[model samples]
Target: MKSYRIIKSPTEGFYKEKGSKFLGFAYHVNSLEDVKNKIELLKKEYYDARHHCYAHLINDGNQKLIRANDDGEPNHSAGDPILGQIRSFDLTNTLVVVVRYFGGTKLGVSGLIHAYKTAAEDALSKAEIEVIQIKQSFVVEYGYEKTNDVLRIINDFGVEINNQEFLAACTLFGRIEPEKYEALKDKLNLVHVKVSKT
Candidate 1:
């Protein structure tokens, strides 16, 4: 199985039709439940909007699932297009909501589709995406004198420090990238340090 990182921040866009306002919102979420919660929050925030259509794609490394709602748009005009945009980007753990204010002028079926697609694209463009990895944890210990050097080396190596605790003479913490265990051991050994798998 393969894993990838999700978007780092929420994205939003606003568009207008005739005299009506539409707001498109996108969020990178971790789970289906989180997506639902976000949608509810948006609904509350924009209580007067005429419609709140939404879609989401949830990926758990091995499999992916999609869910969406049209709110009150004409059948497939709103939700499906938003969902298609998510799929087109190969994105996961993401949800998008397009809020329409009726605009007084009804955008025909084709116009509505275009509007929804453009809204999704605009929101996606503002998002910052990142890649994340699942890794094991380890604890490395060293004398006080070597602490600074170890910290620098860990930072330079791009390893994540999960937690750190201090004892009388040394620092202990958890780290990731199990494959780098041997390499880290070598670096510590050169500095007269020791590592314990946690």
Candidate 2:
């Protein structure tokens, strides 16, 4: 299990160099679907922009996903700096997209890198950052006779109950911080409770 920082809300920032304007947007994202949705929305909202360079940092439970697209700019000049800013903040599960509007003047590679980096940094500076525990889901099943014990364990570990079914055997679908999962599972096993990963 690991803890990482993420933006709490959307934020925007702007930077200009030699008449070229870079508008940066930062978002808290949990999945690739969220990334796609925001990218589509931004493209539509800023249709007149010349370039839509972007970067993402996602730390899923099993792996960390990171990518940056330079769009049409010089290779590594746009997206790399944006990704650098994200790493500088030690943040994950976040995306930063920079929309470039040509102002009839061109900024060379160094200038473009500085502009994109500044814009991304400024956007992140305006964001509300939060640290969250990585969690995993599990489905626990036990007879009604052990219902009280199960509830006690759930409450004690502050597990998040996603769903529950009270049938022949009470089944609880929940998520718990990874650090606590093994210990909790062992305790439940002592009571003959079955815990399976969801």
Candidate 3:
């Protein structure tokens, strides 16, 4: 419940109908800016393509921001279908783009939807899906003598350390699931570790 799935790496897919070629791309995006950058890169790469339709979901496991663009395609023919595939896969923080290279033949609304859907599905199928826990950063500070106790407690809670300094005082920057934050506080209290949200 405190986790979500996203693509681990960028991937590509292809679908063809009549003479038209559909090239699909998948990526894991971290923010709205990331989504824009990716789409801009693709548009630059396929500047001459007929249309570049895309769908994206940003901020996985938190506030979800989603968008679908049909570009020049007919209404609901391209973007919606691609979005449907992303939803079907239960993916978050992901973006799927399909570049269209017109082939002499025209794909009606139905045909376009099918083509876009299949292309998006192909790209997703090729990607490696990874699950990430929804977590928040916390700073834990403790005295030198309580280092062992603090380490043991954090380790027991599966908190991932991001930074640490063992000077006169021991300070650790880490990420832990929000659901476990309260329990972590309780356990760390016993060890006298000072913990605060980052």
Regions more than 4 Å wrong, model 2? 60-62
Residues 107-148 of candidate 3 have per-residue lDDT tens digits of 899999999999999999999999977788999988889998
Let me know the TM-score candidate 1 reaches against the reference structure.
0.67
Write model 2 residue lDDT over 88-146, tens digit each, in one string: 99899999999999988878899899999999999999999998876789999999889
Model 3 clashes, total count = 0
**Ranking of candidates on TM-score, top first:** 3, 2, 1
Per-residue lDDT tens digits for candidate 1, residues 1-198, read 234646789999777767767789989987878987998898899999888998889876567868878887888998999999887776778998998888788888888888887788788778888876666577777777788888877786677777776665676676667677788778877878778776
Q: What TM-score, to 2 decimals, does candidate 3 have? A: 0.90
TM-score of each: 0.67, 0.86, 0.90
User: Whole-model lDDT for model 2 versus the true structure?
Assistant: 0.92
RMSD of each: 4.9, 2.3, 1.9
Q: What lDDT score belongs to each candidate, Candidate 1 first?
A: 0.80, 0.92, 0.92
Which pairs of residues clash in candidate 2, taking residues 3 or more apart in a chain or in different chains? none
What alpha-carbon RMSD in Å does predicted model 2 have with respect to the real structure?
2.3
How far in Å is the alpha carbon of 53 misplaced in model 2? 1.6
Clashes of 1: 1
Model 1, C-alpha of 151: deviation from truth (Å):
17
